[model samples]
Target: GPPRGRELEVARLVRQLARERIHNVVFTAADVHYAAAHYYDPTRAQFRDFEPFWEFVAGPIHAGTSAPLPMDNTFGPQVVFSKGAPPGQTLSPLAGLQFFGQLDVDSRSRTLTVQLKDASGQAIYRHTLQARRA
Candidate 1:
């Protein structure tokens, strides 16, 4: 959720979806100074690999220190909680997901449409959201 374009936005969206499902989380650990992230995978009904999506977020981590200083390698993001909610109610972690796809809304129909594509402009995901007026 740095100062990068679309990254933070996608993070926010992802966070919202997670919240809708009542999930808590940490964040992507860029260095060796952060706690691990956590999320429960509904599809598998178990814990799954948690990683932050970034420009470098998606790929390998390259650690380079000063000409004289040595550094340790990182293994990417970690998921702390895989299942079950904690006792009582608690505030949720921040969701910093911004979608990389096109989003459209129909005001009259109260419907939302999302179109997703891969890096090569191939369609990957498409979803439509509609609500009946109460």
Candidate 2:
């Protein structure tokens, strides 16, 4: 969501991926300084065709940290889980809010599980999604 030359490019790519029959699409990025989970449902949006997908964000492994940004909801994403450092608290290992994310893909089971964890490896949130049938 950072200053990309054309923001529409992101949506175009997402549409292409969906049109190509891609499933379980997920996006991850660092340096956002927070941890949160969101799900995008095409049925809930004005523009249709894109399939539902999940977005998990985790970051600030050691650098400066901040709170999770408010959801834009342009893509009809529902906030599944979200955690942020309290006001006046620095997001870091010492603050016990610094976090990371893990993604497990089981081809045999056709399942994907995402987890966000703290420095001690305790899960703050977990989500499992199964691939839809053709």
Candidate 3:
């Protein structure tokens, strides 16, 4: 999670991007010791001046796994998918809670595909996004 005031900064940036007509902006992050997919939509956000976007989170390929944290609603983020240890529990890497993510971009179609995989390299969740034309 970001420190205090960071979300406001992000909201400001989002509004600026919308003013510039930027679209299909995606964000990826790790280090939460879990895997999840979130979708942010201005229509459902507290700050509603930006377009919808996607944020992918994954990590801890070889470390202990922590439970998913509560999401902030400043950006109106909805959890599309999430996998993590049970509440109040931590799983070691050997417990098979490890995960990794893959992203593929196609220039011809201007699309982005995101996949979250387990230790065995099997995809557990997948999503594809078609870029908006400028």
Candidate 4:
């Protein structure tokens, strides 16, 4: 998770981008000991001046797995998908809870695909984004 002040600063930047008509903004993060996908909708945020965007989180490829954490509400993140250890339990890497993410961009079609894969390289979750026309 990010510091609250920094998150707010990012929110302001996103608001500025929205005012400039920017679109198709996406964010990625890792090292939270879990894998999850989040969608941020300005309409649902405490700060409502930004456009919608997607965030993909993945990590702990060889560490203990942790359950998903609560997202800050300033940007209104909705957890669209998540996979991790159960509550009050931390699974070791050998437990098959390890994960990594893959991203593929298709320049011709202006699309991006994201996949969260397990230690054995099998995708457990996938999502595709179609770039918005300028």
Score each candidate by Cα lDDT: 0.32, 0.76, 0.88, 0.87
The TM-scores of all predictions, comma-separated, are: 0.27, 0.83, 0.91, 0.90
Per-residue CA lDDT of candidate 4, range 1-134, in tens?
A: 33276676886788798999998888888859999999998777887888899989888867899898777778888999999999878988888898899999999999999998988999999999999998
Better of 2 and 3 by lDDT: 3
lDDT of 2 by residue, 21-62 (tens): 887678876657778888888776554557888889887787
Candidate that beats the other on lDDT, 1 or 4, i.e. the better one: 4
Best by lDDT: 3
Model 1, CA-based lDDT: 0.32
Give the clashing residue pairs of candidate 3, or none: none
Lowest lDDT 10-mer window, candidate 1? 59-68
lDDT at position 50, candidate 3: 86
Question: What tens-digit string does per-residue lDDT give for candidate 1 at 1-134?
Answer: 12145444644565564555532222232332111223323333222222232211110122221111221112222243111113232222222111124557788887765554333445445555564333
Worst 10 residues of 4 by lDDT: 1-10
On the 0 to 100 scale, the lDDT of residue 8 in model 4 is 69
For candidate 4, the lDDT comes to 0.87
